[model samples]
Target: MEKLKPKLFSVMESYNGQQFIKDVTAGIIVAIIALPLSIALAIASGVSPERGLYTAIIAGFLVSFFGGSRVQIGGPTAAFVVIVYGIIQTHGFDGLVIATIMAGIILIAMGFLRFGSLIKFIPYTITTGFTGGIAVGIVAGQIKEFLGLDMGAVPSGFIEKIKIYSESLHTIDLSALLIGAISLGILIFWPKITDKIPGSLIAIIVSVLLVKSLNLQIDTIGSVYGEISASLPSFHIPEADFKTILQLIQPAFTIAILAGIESLLSCVVSDGMIGGKHRSNMELIGQGIGNVFSGLFGGIPATGAIARTAANVKNGGRTPIAGIIHAITLLLILLVLMPLAALIPLSVLAAVLMMVAYNMSGWRQFVELLKTSPKSDIIVLVATFLLTVFFDLVIAIEVGVVLSSFLFMKRMSEVTEVNGWKYVEDLTDEDYINDIENIKYKKVPQNAMVYEISGPMFFAAAHKFIDITVEGKVKKNVLIIRMRSVPSMDVTALRSIQKIHKTCKKQGITLLFAHVQNQPMSVMKKAGFDQLIGLNNFLPHTDDALARAEQLKCS
Candidate 1:
């Protein structure tokens, strides 16, 4: 319960009027930046533009009020576009809503289970790969609008989309194309002019004015998706059955995992900027609560948006109040200014998404990984990217994780080694000994040999131990096995140890154990390996194990 407490309460304790002013100012600015983006992302996600505002106002508010991070602004993000679009296309609006709610539940469970920190286990290569793939998908999805092509419906399949775009290339609307190009140009260069306002907002305003004043034949939001709804969202539950729940389980899990990863990543970035540590579990819970309400309010899945969070931090936001205010600002816009959004050209929104796709691509990191990372890492990176682009994010992540685990095991197996220790004379030097008692330790007895095992003794590396200690080792009157550096072992490794003991018994040679760590000792005792090897043979120190080995040699 202590870990689940929101950062808002703590920050409010020391909150001052000056900070409140700063928070309000920053919140308003971030809301301005979030407005056009929310619309663009919603359209991209195959939803009504108002639903995006609903998520921004509703989820954004809930996440801030209950979240762990002080400055993180929550809402719909580019990362969810592909997955959300696919869910809607396959399962319908109700299915999407149900899945989102389920995902929210899953996220809450994750937080309560303290699995938030485990999100970092997702490899960097996999994240970069999927992110770049998503960027490509976003860009492809926008081609029709960006070019103003004569297409009724765009296919979601990556290859099919390309084919459709190719067939429709001849039907490009010149007016829409010009508007899109100008919008993109402004988005790219507007930052040089001013930083007070967002480039996307400026681009949309300019494009809408140009299209409306010139009476150009172009597709505006109102022309395509109909009039923007100005009414507040009402709560409703999505219909779900056992069959639907079963069918949606996979997609819901995917959404939950993605939400957790993205939110935590955003929190981490914000933490670096503000020098504050966020409770990861609490953030997950906040995201869960936010998503549940977002779905109930007819909005899509939502998470922490890095760009919005960074904007919050840069604009003097140091607490959750800024996020809460940002949501209020969006709600006010939804009530008053939503009608103007209908006049904005779809092509301009598409242009805004194009810029978003470009920023989120992470192509620089991809290129760098390919150039510098190992072959195995590159393989995972490229494979995940291709799978995400050509197939699905779920498949990409599943395969990427399995492939990375196998590669990691292989590397671990390669590093784990068992070999005879021939440095006894080096240890016997007077200079290396601290006392006369230590210097008088017994040397290796005749026909007795000492072997050391290094690295974790897991299933993959167990074969190395078997190969080196059981099969390839020289015959001896007594054998001393040292495991000082070995931190842990699995059942397979324990079986391998048992095999070594059995082989020594068969050969009529004594087997001794030394410097066993606590975990391995527990495993050995549990598996009855200690009794089989004899309790006297288990020594706490290498010197004692060597003395026991010599005693066995004499016997």
Candidate 2:
């Protein structure tokens, strides 16, 4: 529970007026950076611009108040755009709400079950692959707005989108294209001038002003979505039938996984920036609470936005108070200034997302990985990337994880060795004191044979062990199995050994184990293998096992 405690409560012990001022200033700055981004991400996610603010205000507040990280700022991020859009298209906004709530529950349960650390097991290759795919997907999604292509209802799926966009190239509005190009140029170059204000915000302001002053025939948010609400969102309970819930389970799980991974990654980044440690499980709980409330308030899925969190840390925010203030600032803006957002050009937002996609693509890392990674890893990475682009994210993640697991097991099985030990070589000078006794010099009965087992004895290698031990034409009166190198054993391996013991007994031959490691010993003891093979035959070393084999031969 101590590890699950929120950083807000801990930071409150040293909270002061001076730090509060710093937090307030930092919070306001992050809110300014988040303003245009939230709107752009919301519109990109196939939801209204105001829903993004609702998410920033509600989820952001809850995550900051209850989260483990001192400087995490939570809101809708580019990563969720594709999945959210797909869910809304398939199941409607109500279905999305239900899925989000279920995802929140899953996150909370994961936190309680201490699965925070387990997320690290997700292979980096898979993450990189999917992230690149998502970047491409985001760029594709924005084409309709970016070029202001006059198309009748853009279709879903990557291939279908490309086909529709290609067919609508003739309808590109010159005004929208010019505004988009200008916004993109601003986003790319404005960072050279200053980092205090976000480039996206500047781009929006410049494009909106141009459209208004020139009376350009550009499609603004107002033209598309109508009048934007300038008030707080009203909470409503989401309702769904069991069948719908069951149907949406996969998407719900995907949302939970993305939220957990993104939030934890943000926490890690913020922790490094501030030189602080974060309680990951507590962060998951905070995210869970945030998403549940965000869904109820008509918002889409939300997670920790890395850019905003970094912005919070950079501007002297050292506590969760900054995050809280960020949410409050956005809320105030929503109440007073949200309607102005409608005047912003959609092309400008599309340009902002284009820049976002560029950053999120991680193309450099992907190329580097391809150049340096192992063949098996490259397979996983490429498979995940292709699946995400050509198929679905759910399929990509599921197949990627399964492929990684199988490849890992195959590699493990390859390294595992079960060898028959012949005459031991004379290397007394290099041998340890315990291994000084040479089996070559020892007088072993002619009817006895020794076999050595190495590496983990899991199900993957269990069959190999069995085939070598039990399927051979063994004329030996006794078998001495050396397991000093066997570090671990699974039930399948244990069952394999039991089968060997059974075959040896039926053939009137004795089975003896030498130097069994702790894990295998415990398994054998628990399964009564020691008693079944006779307790006296469980020797501590090869010499003892040889002595026992000699006795069995003499008997």
Candidate 3:
């Protein structure tokens, strides 16, 4: 079980001025990188640009203050864009607020219940598939903004969005295209010039200047969303009914699951960079607190941003202080300079998001998995990806998890086996007691036989156990069973063993066991199978069982 203690408390005892300076510098730099990204992700999520800043300021502050990771930067992330858009479109902004709040409660409960370690059970193929799908969805959503197409509301469906974009191609504004191209060029090449300032900030400044000087007829944030709010976010409760809460359960769960996965992943990555361990459950609680407040203050869902967290590490951030400073810096910018954000062209932001989407895509890993992974993994990957792209994320994740579980069970069943022993000269199969154990050299009475069971004995493999152990037609005075390789047993497999004991009794054959491991032994003892078979029948080794069998034959 993980202790719900924040990293801040642990690091502060040894904190010094030198490290504080580094933290301050790192935090400010991360804030600069997060500014445009927060805004872009918010607009992409179908909300006003200022809501992004609100998330950065509010959620960002709370997560850092209470989070488990030393330098994790929390804010609006690209992963939530598609889901946020869909939720808002289907249920409206108020409904989204309610759903986000519900998600916060779910996360909080998960943290307290110690479910942090279980997040790893979600298959890697599913995560990769959905992440790539999200990247594609982001690109699709940005198409209109990137091309400056004259169009109304874009469809949420991927195929419909593509069809709509194609029909609207003729309406592309060349000036907006030029801005997007120039912004992308700056982003690609500006880091070579200097790494002190973020390329995104530079791109936004240049794009704003270009629009102002050339009087380009492009859609700026102000033109689209009106004057950006410089005032602080106001608190308001989202109204909901019993029916609405029930209806929003799936989406809320989706948000909670994604937030948990991404935040923990960020913690793992940052732990490697800083050589520090993070309390995963604590991080979940921090995220829950951040999100709950973020919704109350009119912001979208937020989580630990991997890119910003990495940037914090690279720039000398070593404590939660850095993350705290980053949030404060964003707040200052929101109060002092938020109005200027409206002057930036929407096309430039689109290009920034396109870069984000490309990074999120992970195409290299996807291709490698496709080429080298097993056929079952390939099916999960493809199924999750297609579902996310064509359908919705809720469906993609639900189906992917269920599919992976079934495939895992199938693989487990394949490895389980029950085999009768053979003489060394007959064949040296590993499954049978052979020359490896030198058991074949032992003299076996004509009235006795032996069998070995391997792998986990679960419900899926119970039938195989019955077919080989109980259904055998051979009648013998004594029977010996080996189970050294079996690590565990379930109720179903225990029942099969019971069947074998009953059958052996009815046939007037003595049933004996050898090399039973702890788990299976416990199950048998708990179920009173030991008493049923008689305590003396359970032998420590095959040699003992064989000796006992000889005595039984003589009797």
Top-scoring candidate (TM-score): 1
Query: TM-score-based ranking, best first?
Result: 1, 3, 2
For 310-411, candidate 1 gives per-residue lDDT tens digits of: 999999999999999999999999999999898999899999998999999989999999999999999999999999999989999999999999999999
Residues 214-267, model 2: lDDT tens digits: 999889999999999997799898677789989999999999999999899888
State candidate 2's TM-score: 0.94
Q: Model 1 Cα displacement at 357 (Å)?
A: 0.9
- Which pairs in model 2 have colliding backbones? none
Off by over 4 Å in 2: 424-447, 469-475
Q: TM-score for all predictions?
A: 0.96, 0.94, 0.95
Taken over the whole model, the C-alpha lDDT of each candidate is: 0.90, 0.89, 0.91
Q: Model 2 has how many clashing residue pairs? A: 0
* Of candidates 2 and 1, the better by TM-score: 1
Per-prediction backbone clash count: 0, 0, 0
Candidate 1: which stretches are off by over 4 Å? 422-442, 469-475
